[model samples]
Target: MAILSSNYSLESTYSLESTYSLDSIGLHTGLIKCPNCGQFHSNAMAPHGHAVWADMPKDTVDLTQDLIKMGVYSSEVVDLAKTLTENQLKVSLSQFFRDSLFERSASRNRLILEQPDLEQPDYELNSSNLVDRLCLEVVQEAGGIQAAFAAAFGDRQGELFENTIKTGKFNRRQFLARVLTVAALIMLTNCQKDNTADLTSDSPNDLAQKLEKNQLKIGFMPVTCATPIIMSQPLGFYEKYGLKVELVKMQNWAQVRDAAIAGELDAYHMIAAMPLAISLGLGSARFPIKLASIENINGNAMTAAIKHKNKVKSAANLKGFTIAIPFIYSMNNLLLRYYLAAGGVNPDRDVKLVVLTPADMVIKLANGEIDAMMCPGPFNQTAVAEKLGFIHILSSEIWPGHPCCCLATGQPWIEENPTTFRALNKAIIDGCNYASQSQHRPEIARAIAAPEYLNQPESLVKAVLTGSFEDGLGNTHNVRDRIDFDPYPWKSFSYWITTQFQRWNLMPSNVDHEAIADEVFLTGLARHLAKKLGQTPPTVILRKEQLKYDQFDPTDPESYLQGQIKKHGF
Candidate 1:
């Protein structure tokens, strides 16, 4: 059941009996009771498999667990464990890596350090070999059949090591050979793990640098909007890039915003407008937040309560109706306004817009507290699945390539830890690519639909992903872009958002939208991030700035704002 086995001596908890000696003459031979079995012995080697973790930290001990998850070996963990005769570069670190009391290094545990480079040795174990032999060998290496028994199999094997010592079969060569065999087995085992992907084609040392950072805390809402960010953890994207991130799920955008402002989170998913909102100080504290990539595109829908589905035939029918949006400064709100305006209903005057968390919106829609919501999926897909609501307008219909959730961080953090930011940027973009492929949608659904993660029905998530599902009106349809992912944070998309922010008067109209867009949406950062890591970053196909509907444009925003129906003045 343990993640690591077979003399997994890399454990942070281990203790071997310490021995001392006093001899006066041949008549006085040192004799002490074996602390292990309470039998008489000379050396203090009697504690027998107690707490001999020595100096290894729990994180160090648990390092191999990630290896098992990633299916790779940690050469760094090995280096920390012990340097054998083969490690010509470093001296015998036996004293440093011993079964003695020492404090585990605090700095080493925060970042998911790089998987070590284990030079595939002179010997290789093919896939056919089971590890039972390796296990027996490790049990023999503690040099005492008794100690090895206790360490490997527990206290059941009584005095076996002692009896073996008496038989004189215990040689230094055999002990050394066993240790090397066990270590080799650990390396080969890593190489054999399932999904043996070489995520970082770079050298192990290069990968180590790419993954350096403190314990990373990334905030996310348990919605499909944060799919790549959340799924990256379970999918090994984070580990591949050298980040040890704890995905903290927040209840609402407000909470996510608050945590980011307070520096409680290192990075997070944001509605495309959040970086601009945070930087302009439109919401809480004025933190200069910057976005590196757009995590998704057109992954949202406008849904109406089941009772109102027949009553609302089109956007114009939504006149005087109440609608919910997840955040005041959200792509949902802006896109909803665009869709509503095009339908001849003034979004600002004809309908009431309220902020609701995606989770809360579903309940409110079901309870009749809200008539409709321009929400993200799989919540949109969920509403349909529960028969609580039906999709009225897919966001893609409004602006086919509209940017939605983004991978954002405080501007200061990026400048301070460029390499670290670059590392994170690469991971998220990689995840975006993985999720973008249709072939991977089913697996992606399984990854994000787990209770600890999205906590939504897998079928709904899968439906949202594949763009094929029941529409809550008894009709079925397939729309491939129902919920899609792309990493480019286009400047034009920011311009569109900026115009909406102005049209809605969320902030002063006088601010420079283009300047703000350039700073907040750094597609350049996303592009250059990989190149910095010694890898050519993938060329981004930014959801083309082409506009199918003539209502919105990145340039010449004033005309679009003027043509809109009733607008906010706040």
Candidate 2:
């Protein structure tokens, strides 16, 4: 019996002059025939428990063939040997064979021991099927491999695994390697005990300990404006910062608002103005909600039915025609009203403004229930894709960098869970920075277009994010800045939204816009986090904004609103 060391190379062949008996080598007293030579050889066990021929062959191929004839054949073993030979890896064949056989035997024995009652008529008892069943059971127990990866590593790593699998980057061998690595990590995490002394300050365990709540439910509507919030889940931003977030899909803004107000959601995605309105108790019972960060900027667009392309080129032609706005508190409503008034069409009186959910907008326009819709993508883009509507104007065309949607959480929740809130804010801001890059748009579109998120066609979502699509007017446009993201919760945005709320008679005339803006915006926190993340946030809280027909001075919001009222003849 020979014992192979780690340095024993398979390239070197050795012939033993002395033969060992079966009892001395722990063999089964059998003579196995070499398939190639048609000669019977005494089989004996090596020191490492591998079957070895007493009279070994001089060639590696003949040794491999003999092993195969002795019932030690497995694709993995053969493939590994071939790979090692191709790569010139200095591994001993005997050691490799022993380790592979040991692992296989141990795995089979463990599974059989764990599931003793294996006499089912339909169940296959083969080792391959048993291993596959075990793997599936483990994955199911961990709520699928993606979720398990998220739990063991983070969301971003999980997303990488998902993409790798989806894009065929992982061949069978590479996939098995990754699965084994992730499984090992998951087992280690599960076996870890609570020991603060072993944890670093920035470790996930330490951060989780500091958080008031690690698990949270956040609400969002399936719109492109909620890109940062929606993409954060699938892209792994949330788990990157030590959070386990479950995104609850809401039907509309009203449902989102109600859920936030009812304390059913830990956080939510909302229009930029909703925190102010909710804080002021304008739309719902007064709830002190804080805008953690702006989710997206300039994603809204005005889309009109394709049939009205010639008849309704401008808002002036929209008089007496019914148009849809997602919600009264949304930027869609304010910007649409602003555009209509600029075109000498009073949105309130000259044209009927109806509140319709964005999800129903395209269908409503197609059915002739509404003439136009002012909403977010991919609904606007979906209209164009289905030939129901052509984009009349993008909000960016009206205001180049207008704030649209925001990430919000109740003030009380923030107060109780400040650490968790900061983590959540950082995750969302990271998502914003990621989505702000045009290169990531298509990947984001594919990620969020699944049934759990947007539930829209991938092409429609891709067109909206990539900003390259047909306009339903015999034109292909590539407007890269069509929808953009900025996480900074600018106070000027709040002031502008409040002014619009008052301009449309949604809020009282005497309300303190500046004070409400200061209370709800959380600009200081946004600035701090933005700077922490290596972003250049504005030095001041307010900045002047240029609109299509007018400009806004945040320092003199009242005067700006008065000028707007006078210009529109309000």
Candidate 3:
């Protein structure tokens, strides 16, 4: 019997006369050639009178024939066929599929595929509409058809599927049969557990007992400085440490602070000075935050509007102009202030410093709302990419080897989950080591540029990470140290940051900078982890930092601050 009529034009459908001889297969039998595999298989009825193929292995076909003798419909054999096909599907489909197959397989049979109730809503006879209905019926529980396509195939294949669907490359019969086959395959496989186990010397139960938490939500902003934290998810660094981490992309520094304070984020990517600020309750409630490791160093730049290319040649020229900073507690603000103070331009009185998200800073600069912006990459690179601004000065020029961002967590959470914390820090340190290599920067940029992470153009991100970029002034500069990763959390960095706070009058003068720096920056932990990871950390925690205007001795931060006050007259 003919299972269903083909909803395809005569020119599109394969000619049975030339492709196959009907006399050999017998037309009356419910058998048809699968256009996908070119193998004959038994056909069954699907929703909307579509044909579903029972394309099983020879042994499974014999088993189905045995069941057929017992009066079972061929549709029941479709389940077994699906199981075999799903087993043969490649694992590189998508991360979603791997997670779904391994995590939610036990409840696979319960997946309810909702049928479209609308009859002839967009022309039922249309081939495109027929395939759309088939997709809807199969993947309705998986966030509709497009999401299913993404989960079943990675980004590249998903795009191909979209293009093919749009161009109506597959007729209704071919598309419906494939959809039914895939749907059945996934449904059956969902009931089975993945046999491959990734374990260590300790048993599963022992490992689970040792770690207080294996799952965590790490918050991060969409900036290139958070490259290590963001790339760890896609690169399997977190998985290597036996962690199931969900990277929550936050909007702004304030949102990250609020989320971390509210206990919504177990850990987060924070500006180097934020831990000190949060611990002292400067801009947030008293939350004892610990700096695990410095994420990136010197990944910031002062970008000015294109029109101000010649007008704002130096920091002194920035006087009487408005500038944008990522946050009040960020290195962008501190470094910009330091650079301006050295140029005899008081950041507070000379240039207006407005707080804005990095993403919005580019827009505001393009709109001529802000004359300049001192923020982290690739926003500065983005402005250059769009020809809205030119790189005025890199933060490395202001203070070489300055700590830009850090990986931080609540001190209480760390104490509660010590083992998990160690594992998490190890993963972050590994990611940092990976990102430090100049050869890996291009790959790192591509991995983090996905919509879930930085969500910027790949070319723009590559330019920032690779340190080969146009400065929007017809100059291509290649500076490898523009952004570099080092996991060490130097106590000297904290001392310098606190000294800046004192210099800017952001913190009390008598606030025990040494004690706070020692308590907030986990230098000891970072040193230990770095050594354990086979990386040589600095033997001493204190070091002298040379800035554009003056030198900062960590051992004598008080003297440095007093001298800064004497020099800049702050």
Give candidate 1 misplaced runs (Cα > 4 Å): 1-199, 202-206, 209-214, 530-548, 563-570
TM-score of 2: 0.65
| Residue-by-residue lDDT tens digits, candidate 3, 1-570 | 112332322221211111122212311333443322233455442223324224422343343343334443334333333332232222112322433455555532211112322111111211212333334433443455466666555555443444333333232233333333332222223221111122233444454555667888999999999999999999978777677899998989999888878878789999999989999999779898989899999999999999988887888899998999989999999999999998899987888999999888999998889998998888998898888999999999999999999999987687566667777887888899999999999899899999999888999899889999899889999989899999888777888899889889888888676678766877655665665677776654556688887877665677788898798788
RMSD of each: 23.3, 27.8, 26.4
Q: lDDT for model 1, please.
A: 0.62
**lDDT agreement with native, every candidate:** 0.62, 0.68, 0.69
> Which 10 consecutive positions of candidate 3 have the poorest summed lDDT?
117-126
RMSD of 1: 23.3
C-alpha RMSD in Å of predicted model 3 compared with the true structure: 26.4
Cα-lDDT of candidate 2: 0.68
Q: Could you tell which candidate, 1 or 3, scores higher by TM-score?
A: 3
Of 1 and 3, the candidate ahead on lDDT is 3
